[model samples]
Target: MNEKEALILKLIKEDPFISHFDLAAKADLPGDRVAGYISSLMKQGKIVGRAYVLPEQRQVLCVGGANIDRKIWSKGVLELGTSNPAESSKSCGGVARNIAENLGRLGSGVSVLTAVGEDHEGHWLMEYTRAFADVAPSEILKGHSTGTYTAVLDQEGEMTVALAEMSLYDSITPEFIDRKWSYFASSDFIMLDTNFPADVLNRIIERCRKENIQLCITPVSSPKAKKLPHDLLGVTWLIANKDEAEAISGIKIETEGDFFRAAETIIHKGVEKVVISRGDKGLIYFTEKGEAGVLIPPAISIIDVTGAGDSLVAGIIYAHLNRIQTEDACKIGMACSILTLQSIETVNPILNNQQLLETFKQNFK
Candidate 1:
């Protein structure tokens, strides 16, 4: 919080969509100097949070994977042998889709740019999404089967073995993304996932960067996400877990120092900021100059942890876009995660601003 850094933050907070040149002038510093200060401020949690906070009525474009998830649950630590779950159910499970749907529930206009098969499952998924959010069907490539994920949960409701299918998104090429980029031209933010091909993700990130579009990305799965192209850094706000971070950056993170070193390694690779969610341990956020950490207060009870991460991403981005500081955004994310882990679905139980505030109040009190 040097004076220049504080000024730089103020300028960006007032208008996150402003050009760097304009921000530089407003902060009365050299363009590159202002850029450095802004980046530093973000790492320090002064100008921390999303790049844009749109009017509550604006639209948010979510471009990524959509899948149906089937999970089997048992009473105790369910072993993999001879498997019949006590109960089984299906729900939407893709990271991008869950975040988009939850954002819609939070009263933001949401549109999903993804591909789904023309099959029965895709048909049902389309119908379901249309009921809750505005879906850009043109973004969907119809031919391949809809993606799906299956998980086996123990009595503790923790996932054991899980399988993901996302080959359907292979059809989302640059041509497809270019055509649909305009749909997001009027959007407040554009969120994506690693389900897309590296070239396609790079193109999308380039477009967002060239247009000063706020871009967020959630690495869908650790093993599958190991292929993310390093060049797509700097253009996206990366959201991942501890394992995913290790997988993507090729570094192990067991302590805060390790997390710091790992984050620096990735940032030097071109990433602007890294947000890592460490399950029950909480979250760690890092940028070029600094980092912040938080712990998830113990949950009352765990029902299902399936959509918790998605909910957290949505909550943080939503809070940031609404003018909350980055640290507060993490708290908001933690709250959303807590609610989702206590519920069966991936979405938050609360609706509307009043309900959200109330939930925060009751929980903290």
Candidate 2:
């Protein structure tokens, strides 16, 4: 997004009903140029529908990756060295992308910032994801294929092996985010994925701190989590799974006591709050006020766990936006996780505010 385009998006976000003439006047651009910018936004999936109707000003900006996920599950006993029959499925998956979709489905105004290829796969991903959240791709490489993750799973729904081809995310550099820095001014919260480069992570962390913007971060994996800068001063929330928490905290989490300690260690590193998701063991959290608690999810059959963590982040962000209590917010997150775990899709299409509340009521309450 260029400076003028970014400006137009901002003006629209502030007032979605603003006329093209008023927008041009406010942006100090020619009427013809303003029209061109709006047209570009529409083509980019940033602006949808006629008369400049877009979801509210992307209150939450999610930055990281958006990619295709292919999963193959063995129907019977696994044979690693030989051919085996398996059922296959594909869906859109990426930490930031999944979370953004989850939020958008739950009626949160959100936007996704990532990089993609300019090929058919990229186009498909953008169009599909745009159905849930506004798409703001940083760069669309002309020749590169979109990033992809292929996983082999056992009949028990556990991942046996996985491979990632996500080099396309490298285009989402610090400089690229710099161009869209204006977007943050109106965003109520910002979420980042660890797929970003180490420098880009620090740049955003520092920028959020300087701007006093509430920031939340979810690590993509243990290795990427380890890339987060130590000075997390501006980070308001850090929601990480067990491996990610351990990687960032340098603590070997074994007993339940370690979860709180790890969260404290992360807080000492400058985060205001930390959540250590322990998978089936539920999660442990620590607030800036020195408060702490652990919540366990109800046992339930799961179909797939591919995007559960991202959905948890989405639920938590939604709760935070609505001023729900921290403990209850965690419950909502767990409920969202439970729902995602039961779905084959990475982002549950049936999820909505009412369903989320119903799920929470049926499980946690």
Candidate 3:
């Protein structure tokens, strides 16, 4: 990577979900000209995916929301009076962007098809995403004020109450996405988040089915996690946490057995497979043919729990695209998730096939 390319990469690592125009401004280049440089870097493998720039490789396309996550840290969980004895931070967030960044770090050709605002953070988010992966601006709809989530953290850095402003994406219509259907159709794998409107998701699901693309939909958080489109059966993989699993499938999960049952229910509902995460307890996966699970003991300490699921999805897709068996895929997903929980920000840790296999053997065996 040249100086400019290296600079761009640094900027991307600093902001994985930023836009192209902001990159041009930060890199001090004309907008159109900077876009050309980005394309060139992508062609040269400096940025190797369908994510930030135009499509040139068999990349993963993530369709979801991108947001600026603002967190406020206070004491006593806002119940026992305000005891300020902590820190606060702001970071790039959003399910699709998180997965895209993870895929890029894992050395996958990743791209994102999502929407952000025309405002400052939105521009920064777009530039960041482009720098990290292949984010096609054409697919990113403007005018909609970008979404944001504000969380109040307690002493332990655990979020208490989160106010998410996601209604801006309520207007993502099928007509808007019709323009970028080609990118969506050619992706090796398609990951969806419930952030988009139901109709838009329906259109994408229908299109992906027609194009023979594998779809993975994340219900995201527990509260208000939308159910998979009725036609989503057999066409999409269900990724959800224990809480989300219960909400979408109406299955009560009090133990590991319940988790497996929830996953099985989704699988029987038309999903080929389901991965349900029981944080700290590890993850359990159930596929159409059989059921298996893996437990990678927690890595010493947890710095931040954000983006861990996204990283796991990247690992799963990596295994899937590489034709690795389902069991092995779950292991890879677990390994990657552990690595992300240790890092302060999301990063793609490039591991060659041999390296990943070695890590798998040492960690799991």
Candidate 4:
């Protein structure tokens, strides 16, 4: 790496999602010349193409569900058990998939693993996701249908009920994880969602323990949250919503004190850190470093709440990679959640590192 290449690489290291134009401005070079340096970096294997994985920054594998999400929002007050006029939208979604996409959007080296059917939907899911996270480790199951989730929301965009057809996820077994062991072995961090079964989760958690890799686990919902083992000895972070938190901790959370108790319970379960999201009430977090607090998001109009939590996880991971403080990392996460709440899409198309930092500074400071 010569002087110019060294300079560009330094800028890239600082800003994972740095644009070519921004790089040119920072490097004091011609805009068109930035591409050549990027190309050279790619050729020299100093950085991975598109995702820009540098040797110093290890990759993360997000293991869990990947599927089609169909959302239906009622145009007016929803009536129970009756047909109501609604507007519907469809998009690529799933817990791990959304988190991986958000991480990719924020310029992290991330790969998503899941089971998709050998059908057009499966093909399109993999191809569309490739634009964000690496989907090469995902498998396509023959003679099986891809999983799906359908959510019904009220006019306020709050999900009233949801139905999930996620049987395909059963195919993502321990053997499947073994097949992708190389990815896990090379990763410095690994993220898992409860969409995987108990054995699969336990296997990966144990391997992460053996490898001494950092692990973050997100439970998909209240029911699936039970999939986690009683011994969470190797888990680094357990991020969950209030209901899911209640399920995991066996605590009925009706007040602020209950929330803290729940987090403490999970921490005692051997998770290094615990964060329980309280929706509009803000979030409560207890970190491994002994930083604890509640962060309430600044008021903003919410267009949709689909990917807000996933974006929060992405923001924390981004902050950790950048060496941000733990409390502020949660603040960045709160900022990311607020940004995602303003978007109708699952993952906000306009999200980047700069936007997230700006939002953090504006709202949190």
Which candidate comes out best when scored by TM-score? 2
In model 1, what is the error at residue 37, expressed in angstroms? 38
The regions of model 2 sitting more than 4 angstroms off are 1-56
Clashing residue pairs in candidate 4 are none
Candidate 1 Cα outliers beyond 4 Å, as residue runs:
1-58, 137-140, 289-291, 349-351
* TM-score against native, each model: 0.79, 0.85, 0.78, 0.84
Minimal lDDT window, size 10, model 3: 46-55
lDDT, candidate 1, 190-272, per-residue tens: 88878888888888777777767788778888875676777655444677888888987889887877876776777777776
Q: For residues 293-360, could you state the per-residue lDDT of candidate 3 as single tens digits?
A: 75545455776666678877777888888888877787888777767666655443453455556656
- Number of the top lDDT candidate: 2
Candidate 2 global Cα RMSD: 5.9
Compared with the true structure, the alpha-carbon lDDT of candidate 2 equals 0.87
Whole-model lDDT, model 4 = 0.86
Q: By summed lDDT, which 10 consecutive residues of candidate 1 come out lowest?
A: 48-57
